[model samples]
Target: MCRLAMKTASKPFSPFSVLEAMEAMQEGYDGSGLGLLLRGLEFAEYKYNAKDPILSGIAHSEAALARLNKIMIEAGFELKYDHEFDVKRQMIEAKDRFKYILRVYKQSATWASLSAEEVENRLMLTRLALRKDGEAHGQDLTVFSLWPDVAMIKEVGWPLGVGQALGLDSGRITSRICMAQGRQNTNYGINLYACHPFFIQGVATMTNGENTAFIPIKDWLSGRGFPGYIGYQSDSEVFAHILHYVTKQLKLPLETYKHVITPLKNEELAAHPQGDFLRGLRDACRRLIIDGPNAVIGTLPDETSMLVMDAKKMRPATVGGKPGEWAIASEMCGVDAMIPDRDRSKDFQPMREHTVIIPPDRQELQIWSQFDHLPIHQAA
Candidate 1:
């Protein structure tokens, strides 16, 4: 079992809050690892450098750090601000991994002349190159995310312990939205890249159950001709890539994500108001459909957050809160831990036919069902 906790608010909040929610449901996870993805940053430096992409990752040695800086400079990326967190001895699962880097960089001059999509592609390519160089040369560097106003951290340890080790509670690292996971080692050995809260471009996601359909899903995504989809360290990583594929590549509406990943059955589709459209979608994207017991919590580039389940709905999940603050978690107790003052009566537990969505505004909650003609909205 694993636990997921996601929180979004009208203003910046501490990442520790998300971890606290996950810790409240620790019984479900084994404490094998903890992963976090933060968006809409509120750090003091962020106010001045919000447009600069932050390269966040781990470096094993001073040589590795120097090599990374050299590469970025040669590539024309100018470093504007840098912050490093020296990992506590107790949090070091690998002796070589010593610190985390949150370095902000201004793109090369060429970026000024390129289209928005071209600029994004350039950033992704640079990150991929850095990751490949590290692996090939044994530099022991791992870059998790390189996007503006976003940061990611992953380590092999208990939730609160890892958070404390990284000094996340010091009130310096905060965001308007945070997605975190307390991982349970199940199908694979403990690997940092395999941790949850997987991110690509600006899309981020974490999962709580095994993806029996991982192989097919990975294959389909790898064949999409996107270089960023190459890393499949964690089977659940496909969830985030799929989300990016549907929303960004395919240009589909966010609500259609639930339909593509957990499509309605043929019989159920026949009765849906959008049956004809969903039928074509299901058939066209059949390879992306997920199986087994899984619950996914994710955030998009626009700051929207969502929680969805597999067709089986075998995993526990819920969404609840008040205006300007909302949370989606794998357990109701997790929600209670995050927002105790919330209206408990309005708490929603999504089933096989439902998806819970919180828009970027943070002013309302939406529950979209496959069986309904439209989503049901609940005002804050």
Candidate 2:
């Protein structure tokens, strides 16, 4: 009935490996679809030093491919690598198969002086533009993510079988952070764009429960005057965009995102020295507040991975690891599959109102409390 996700500290493990972990917890998900996003990729060595955007998606037809090529060229993007998924090697085939394209773009000289934030924004707009173009032209194009050091693969199938079908070299194809979601169709039809592990710019998020506050949140975000905020295939996609809006757009600290999405009670806020400051933020972004019973796992642009629960903590999540590696998931089985050697007693779960932030270095875990006035307590 929910989704699952996991990430490592620094090691570049295979995305297929992540898929396997999700497969272990498959009982909770119906496997209507599978979505994978990888950052700090190991297979594409050139991408580490490459300064351009790497975009991947499913192109529904040959005309869609031609149109995409035209759009990219018109936008002053020169292709570095253009590839098609090798469907011949896959284990299963759908009644309607989409041609998967992964292209790395070398931006024109005009983009040389763009700031890091601007460059990221450009990639996002480019990807969203492509999706919109595809839709307008009657093409089923779904761009997963467009950025350097990233690649995404998603399809409608079983998790384990989809993993096997990729036919990637397990040793070579890896990333520092990879997310997989075994989707259970609840609201939307079986659209590939509706799959979870949604990514925008560098922020990626997957949720394990339905987001009851999605419509108001979506409406608020769409009104923010940003072109990239138009799509809403999955209600959970708003979480990913909110991460971008909070950290990149508003120039707010990452912790503030937790508060914006799930603000504390006025009574709890009154006890803190920064109570008024927090209250102003809640009032300004009231529509963004989430109604939970949702467990969220996400990765930020700076490589920080996070695990958060809504006020009720209706969905389960566990964070555990040894010294150099830590991971979070909606189930203990997921964490166990990622780092089985770690001491089980050390596993910690965030309570109903806490955000557990794990940095890339994996040196320590930082728990941010919405209820800052009270002492912190881990879920037992």
User: What are the TM-scores, per candidate, against the unseen true structure?
Assistant: 0.95, 0.92
Clashes of 1: 0
lDDT of each: 0.85, 0.77
lDDT of 1 by residue, 96-192 (tens): 7756888888889867989889888988998998888788777488888888888888888899988888788788778899889887346777777
Error of 2 at 380 (Å): 32
lDDT per residue for candidate 2 within 1-380, as digits (tens), equals 66586877576777777777787798888877788887776554444444557888877777787888898899999987665444544475564445677677787678889987677778878888888887887656667778887778888788778777656434546778887788735688877778888887778888888888989999999999988787787888899888888887877777778888888788988876677778887898888988877888888766788888887888999999876688787788998888888898989999876888888787778887875542212111
- The segments of candidate 2 whose C-alpha lies over 4 angstroms from its true place after superposition are 44-50, 83-90, 373-380
Candidate 2 local lDDT, residue 132 = 84
Which TM-score value belongs to model 2? 0.92
lDDT value, candidate 2, whole model: 0.77
In angstroms, how far off is 125's CA in candidate 1? 0.7
What is the Å distance of residue 297 in model 1 from its true position?
Answer: 0.5
Which parts of model 1 have CA positions greater than 4 angstroms off? 374-380
Residue 169 of model 2 has an lDDT of 35
